[model samples]
Target: MISGLVQILLFQSLGELVSKFLLPTLPGPVIGLVLLVLWLVLRKGINPDLAMVADGFSQYLGLLFVPAAVGVVLFLPQLQANALAIISALVGSVILTIASSAFIARLLSKRESHE
Candidate 1:
């Protein structure tokens, strides 16, 4: 488990380094996750310990939103000022997401039925 965690961190660090040096626009952790995914795909599976560690981390996922909640509290004034714009964007995104998901589901079902 420790070794698996170390491996993840090492890849994340390498990603950060690469992001700093080569890709200033993309986030380092995102790059690191992409690297991790590619590595896992090539290797054909995840390590048991690594999967266990990931599941453990997933348990506390809700805690990760605490900081963002605090940020919203801190920026309440700014958010209020932009409430209309924010609401519009949120609504628009939700509608778009639902429509796109339905469209994709329809396409997939059609292809699956034919197959």
Candidate 2:
């Protein structure tokens, strides 16, 4: 467990350095995650220790949202003031998501039929 955590932190620190020096646009953690994914893909499998650590983290993933929820609560007044715009944006995003998914599925089916 300690080893896995160390491995994760190592990647995160490496990612931070890369982000600071090379990729100014991306967040350190996201770059770290991309690096981790590439590493896993190259290895062709998840390390057992890493997998175990990830499983433990996944179980408590909901806890990660607490901060965001707190932010929403903190800005409740602003949210309420802009409720209409927020609702419209939410609805628009859902509609766009559904439309894009359908378009992609149709394109995939057409490609499969052609093949």
Candidate 3:
């Protein structure tokens, strides 16, 4: 478990360094995740120990959002003031996401059928 945690941190730090030095526009953590994915793909599999550790962490993922929920509670006043805009934005994004996903899936299916 400790080793897996260390490996995760090491990759994240490496990502942060690369982002800071080479990609000013991109976020460090996001870059680190991309690097991790690339590493896993190149290796063709996940390390069993790391997979176990990740699974353990995934189980508690919901708890990790507790602070964010608390933050929303604290900001209820501000949220209420801009509720309309927020609701509209949320609805719009959901609709757009569904539409784009359907479009992409249709395109992919057409290409697959042709192949």
What do the candidate models score in CA lDDT, each in turn? Answer: 0.93, 0.93, 0.91
Per-candidate TM-score against the hidden true structure: 0.79, 0.86, 0.84
Q: TM-score: which is higher, 1 or 2?
A: 2
lDDT of 2: 0.93
Candidate 1 residues 45-113, lDDT tens each?
999878988888899999999999999999999999999999999999999999999999999999999
Q: What stretches of model 2 exceed 4 Å from their correct place?
A: none
What does candidate 2's lDDT look like per residue over 1-115, in tens digits?
A: 8888887998899889899999978999999988988998999998888988999999999999999999999999999999999999999999999999999999999999999
- Which portions of model 1 miss their true places by more than 4 Å? 94-115
TM-score head-to-head 2 vs 3, winner: 2
Error of 2 at 96 (Å): 1.0
Highest TM-score against the true fold, candidate: 2
User: Residue 97 of model 2: what lDDT?
Assistant: 100
Residue-level lDDT tens digits of model 3 in 75-113 = 999999999999999999999999999999999999999
Clash totals for all candidate models: 0, 0, 0
Candidate 3: 10-residue stretch with minimal lDDT: 1-10
**What CA root-mean-square deviation does each model show from the true structure?**
2.6, 1.7, 1.8
Pairs with steric clashes in candidate 2:
none
